[model samples]
Target: MKLPRMVYNQPEVVQPVRTDVLIMSPWLAPIVWDGTYNLGILNAQYRQRKFRVGITIFAIKKYTVFVKKFIESAEKYFMVGQKVTYYIFTDRASDIPVMNLAEGRSIAVLKVPSYPRWQDVSMRRMEMIRDSSHTRFSHEVDYLVCVDVDMTFNDEVGVEILSNLFGTLHPGMFGLPRDSYTYERNPQSEAYIPADEGDFYYAGGFFGGNTEEVYKLTNFCHKAMMVDKEKNIEAVWHDESYLNRYFLYHKPTKILSPEYLWDDNFGIPAFLKRRRFLAVPKNHDEIRNRR
Candidate 1:
């Protein structure tokens, strides 16, 4: 698709078309994979808003069956004109029935070289986003979201949130504020995560951006992953962690309330839940009800 070229600090003459959010699910049976159900819920929510939804599935040859089923199910609920692109990355030609359904539809299949392990397969997803951002839109998309196939949306994320997050004074990574108790040890030995400096701990599984910023962030992640590859660190979840630190130091990602990207195990405090307009059943059922 041809997207408008964006100039920093300069308003565009034409309103760039906001393509559907791009979600990556790299696995054989993605629906049954991590956060797959949640992704379905979130995809349904996006379709409800009439937003175009494009999904890229990274899987092996045998797993094409499940991928086809997942795409068909998504198409059932999505609006008629709403688009869904299923970019399949695999070694051999796909035997699944996806191609039969894809003719004359927005959906398309792309077969890529196979990777050693399924976990290390995210490289394909990274490449897809990078290529799309750099070439397709000229790196000028309104919001290029990269969410794990597992995350579910509880509320409608309208243009308002995108405007607020990107237009706010603090334009950086938007995610759940970090808490001292649940902090995962920072993997970057060279990079020190200051304790108590900020309230947000970014969740990599669900994060997006002003397209330009996201491009930069993902570019950084790709480079970092390349380094890891050289160092023999095969599956480091580099994309997620790189994004967290990139915004932490780059400061383009605005640190926002945790509700935007909530975690059931470690998330916003009970008292702060309502304050932030976030609802978690466990937190509400246990923490608020007790009070």
Candidate 2:
């Protein structure tokens, strides 16, 4: 069954309460941090050093158009003044469009073999990232962000999102109970999560952390996927299932609100006053099934 669309409208002004400012998850962990950050302070602290931020995205074949849009939007709204390098992994690097970049921002194309199945493309991302970290990424950047190509930065996604480890709350599952979350439930699979335990179902499409931590995460997920493959068992959501299991045992240092990965197709929720990034609507069947 499809979930209801989260809706939002302006609220009436009221006297502020100290308790009202605190953002907590159902498990009572400090998961969401919307108003708690000061962007000016964060930007001032990180921009001075020009922190080397690496963004990794895959745009194999037909998805190149989405990458083009992502690059244009990211330059305008994502960490605008920071030192950022987009490590674009694609089969056809020549398809990447040329765009003007701000000072301290640039792009590098990494050629990856094309996969026939979308599931293979999704699962292989973890392995490729882990391999790339050791060979190329480790020597190039301070932090690494793995994100889907079909998304665009809608607002300032600045230093506030950075940490030792970070995960974005899935827009569709953020409000649901743990049991209702679409986690891999089979015990036989490496990505299983019991019904009684979970903090949040993080979106696999957007996540990042310190260079070392992200490398470890990619390595861990790759190993887990290999184990599942040996048993001929694929999790319900492919790599996403493994990611949920990883975050369960190894909690993220920070949890980004749904604002970071809202779907443009859904109406804004009242709690999400500002949307930092938006998933561009696309024909999922065409993109995933064409092969």
Best by TM-score: 2
CA lDDT scores, all candidates in order: 0.43, 0.84
What tens digits encode model 2's per-residue C-alpha lDDT throughout 13-83?
57322233335544344554566556666665565564689999999878887987899899988877788
> What digit string (tens of lDDT, one per residue) describes model 1 on residues 1-291?
453443334434474322221122122111111211233344444544533333344445444435554445435432234443444444545454634443333544556665554455555556556666676533223454454333334443333233112211111333235444233245543223455654344555445555566667667767766766676654334455455555555653333334444555454444223221122233223321221
Clashing pairs in 2: none
- Of candidate 1, the 10-residue stretch with the lowest lDDT total is 27-36
Give me the candidate number with maximum lDDT: 2
Candidate 2 stretches with Cα past 4 Å from truth are 1-33, 48-50
lDDT of 2 at 165: 86
